[model samples]
Target: MPETARIRNVAVVGHRGTGKTSLVEALLFQSGAINRLGAVEAGTTISDADEDEHKRQLSIALSLTHATWQERKLNLVDIPGDPSFQGELRTAARVVEGLLVTVSGVMGVEVGTSRAWRLGDELGLARVVFVNMLDRERADFFRTLEQLRSQLSPQCVAVHIPIGTEHELTGIVDVLHMCAYASPEGAKEGEPGPIPDDIADIAAEYREKLLDAVVETDEALMERYLEGQELDAHEVAAALKAAVTKGEVFPVACGVATKNLGTHAVLDLLVEGVPSPAKKGSPIDVDGASTAVFVFKTVADPFAGRINLFRVLKGRVTAETTLVNLRGKGKERLGSLLELQGKEHKPALDYAEGDIGGVAKLKEAQTGDLLVDKEVAIEVPDFGFPEPVMSFAITPKTKGDEEKVATSIRRLAEEDQTLHLRRDQQTGEEILSGMSQMHVEVALERAKRRFGVDIELHPPRVPYRETIRREARAHGRYKKQTGGRGQFGDCHIVVSPFEEGEYEFVDKIVGGVIPQSYRPAVNKGIQEAMHHGELAGAPVQGVRVQLVDGSYHTVDSSEMAFKIAGSMAWKDAYMNADPVLLEPIMELEASVPDDVV
Candidate 1:
């Protein structure tokens, strides 16, 4: 296990088309973790392995991959950009202390960029921006830098500037050090060189901008610099790191992830500017001597059981370690831990404190589970997943495949907290809820492909209800005489709209007109009637039924008879009370471009 301070957990996140996964491949290639680089369009990126991800050419889930940079381990969590997958971002934030937010050099700050920035702000994570796709058409580093300053934060400062623009892009200039690096396509390392004569003035201009922001972290350095003294490069670099860790400044770097341009600088930035997990501190309060691990993500593998990915919060974890789950209170024996590089699992020797690793076949563990030493007792806060924004009714293709369909979807929901599966009692239809339409569709597709269960999806039932609009009265009398004993029940009820709440029953009957025992039976009968409304067979809502007066025979007025009388009285009054149908109405706010209007 490496030193805890040498481990840096960073999540790579950005909008779609910003080349986040491509940049991860470049970092992996530059660090020699992988000999070849993979493109997402070709379905070869390490971050995206699911079949649907390949079909859509998008990242659907978070992927964990580590790169060895400058004798340090960089745990790079590649996250999806789509809004539906924001749950993955929250999961990554809990374990990582730094966020490497990718931005398109062409489009600049977009919806995902803003969202990622706001998340980092909320979590107090140090953020670094990478302007990717610098070699694409209409790509402008300076323009994007301005956008970052205006849209994200005025504290945004450029540390690395592109040497060229668009198709002629070649390398980047390290503005802080007044140095240049020339890294062309397929270059593993940026060749150190002098600043080009053509862009020397511009590089100097950015260096001053970098210094102006960096010097504020140290008053003495700022005073000396203000006195016209040249600050030491090392001193400035140290201050920059502190400022970034404190979120006083957000340093921006430029790159074309596809061509591996400017990737080394980003890796160097991660090693230098980002704080280690040990320095950032853990979210869980654990005893110093005991080991603790928080399971942030789970993969439901039908063949391999559950693969749990966790961050070591306290002590080290090895092959012989036994952990007790805080939530389930079950002792889980040690299993061979593995490192998840995309879908490939490599044997991991051990996990040091604050390091993340995956283990398979735990007896009983799920996402958000805190597993620790038996002696250590602590409470783990949940991930607090966002509610699903969309829902669909699901029906299995085969008549008897209901259990299989529900079981598969529930298993997937365990892995994806944003995907929720439930059964509607009113309609008796299985409903699947998710962050978006694509989120639900992808889950259903995965269920069919992996679990061998197919289901049809459509709009969920409206869950409408029925409520009365006016007041009406009716009398119900039941008298059946056939032999020595006869059945007799009489009751008068007034049905009126109760706008405040659902189904209020009042007994205004005085004296022995309706017996006390039979009164409860009448209320029970009215409650049953509330389940099926008179209009559209929907559930009844917001109506009050009152038993004002009635007469009952001494022998024949049993609870059953009174119950039947109450049922009859409710139906008669409901029909004359002018029942109305009610439906759920959704309130939404949308943002549209000006031209669309």
Candidate 2:
């Protein structure tokens, strides 16, 4: 078993195609966690296994993979950076203790880069930036570095300097150690090499900047640095770790993910430079007194049932352990704990605090559920994802596929929080809402592929309401002549506007003109009429109906007769009371292109 303190839960995030996934593959391969490195473009990478992801060549969900590098278990999560799939990034962010935010040297500071950085800041997660794909033509490390410093944070200082230029990218100098790792990715075939001469001056300059931040953490080091005394590599390493733990500095690391340049150096930093859970802070609260475990995602598999991906925030969770799901308000039994490799689940018997795991067949579990011991209950803070801005009206193409559509949509909603489905009340349309047009399109595609359900989508309809502009009185009389008996009833109602959302009915008939016993029947009839609107056929709200006068025969005027009379009178009053159509206007907040605006 790996030491719980030695475990590092880090998520890699940035804009798409920044080599974030490739970095994880390289880390796992070089660490011997996998026999061979898988390429993302070839769709052979372990973490990019979803058909939708492979087809689009873009990750649609969070992928968790693990590897042991130098006896330290690194739980790496590669999160999709697209705004449409941002819920996945938020899910991964809620669990990981640190963030390895990747930046493409060519793009420098991008919209996604800022977004990932903001997410990390919101979670208070320790962060390290890797300027990746430096081997690509036009990849500018120094330009990206300057942009990061200007935009991300001034504290984002480089600790390692790239020794060669783009396309000629070779290795990096560990400014803290004054030693060079020959591999551009880190740790070549044999022992580490000396600093490359070409970038020695650049390395020295960054070394001073790193020391300036690190020395502040220790009084002795501060004095030595003030006196212009050079600290040894080990001292600098210890101070850098302490500074990073305290968030005084975020040491920037650079690498070429495909060429394996600084990948091993990053692993070394995780083991030797990152802080343990104990040093970081307290265990996350479960409900009241118990430890908290948040299930950030749920993956549905037809053959395997479901895999609930969770982050153990406080205590250890073992197989067969029963826990409370605050979201479901029910107790769930953990069948088995597993580690995820993209969509695949590897069974495990135990999971410790701050580590991510998948519990198979958690019948009552869903994404955003806080699982804890039943005796102690606590709410986990949830991530804020963008609300869906567009909607689609969808229906099953065939009667046989109706149930399949519902089931598939429910599963899709579980996988992507921003995807929502509901029956629109006004138009009676089955509406699907998502972040964008593409989001809904992909949802339909997934439904067909996963559940074998075909659906047709249409534009959603707007809801409209009806209201009265002027007060009016109405009287309805219903009389029935049957061969054996007869029915008779009469009612007088005054229709008027109340405060919006306030619906009231008062029995104002005096001297029992309409018997008190039958007045309830009259009000019930009017309320029922209000549900299916009088004008534009929408639910009527915020109106008042008063029973001012009515007449009834105890034997002839039954409840049914009174009900009919009330409906007739209300509809009569609604049509003649200056009724007008009121369209339902939904408050919208969206970020669109300035040009579109």
Provide TM-scores for the models.
0.94, 0.82
Best by lDDT: 1
lDDT for position 177 in model 2 = 80
lDDT for 136 (candidate 1): 87
Best of the candidates, TM-score: 1
- Residue 270 lDDT, candidate 1, scale 0-100: 88
Estimate, for each residue in 399-494, the C-alpha lDDT of model 1 and write its tens digit. Answer: 999999988988887789999888899999888999999999899898988889989998887999888889999988888888888888899999
**Candidate 2 overall Cα lDDT vs. reference?**
0.79
Model 2 lDDT per residue over 8-38, tens place:
8888899877888888888887788777777
RMSD of 1: 2.5
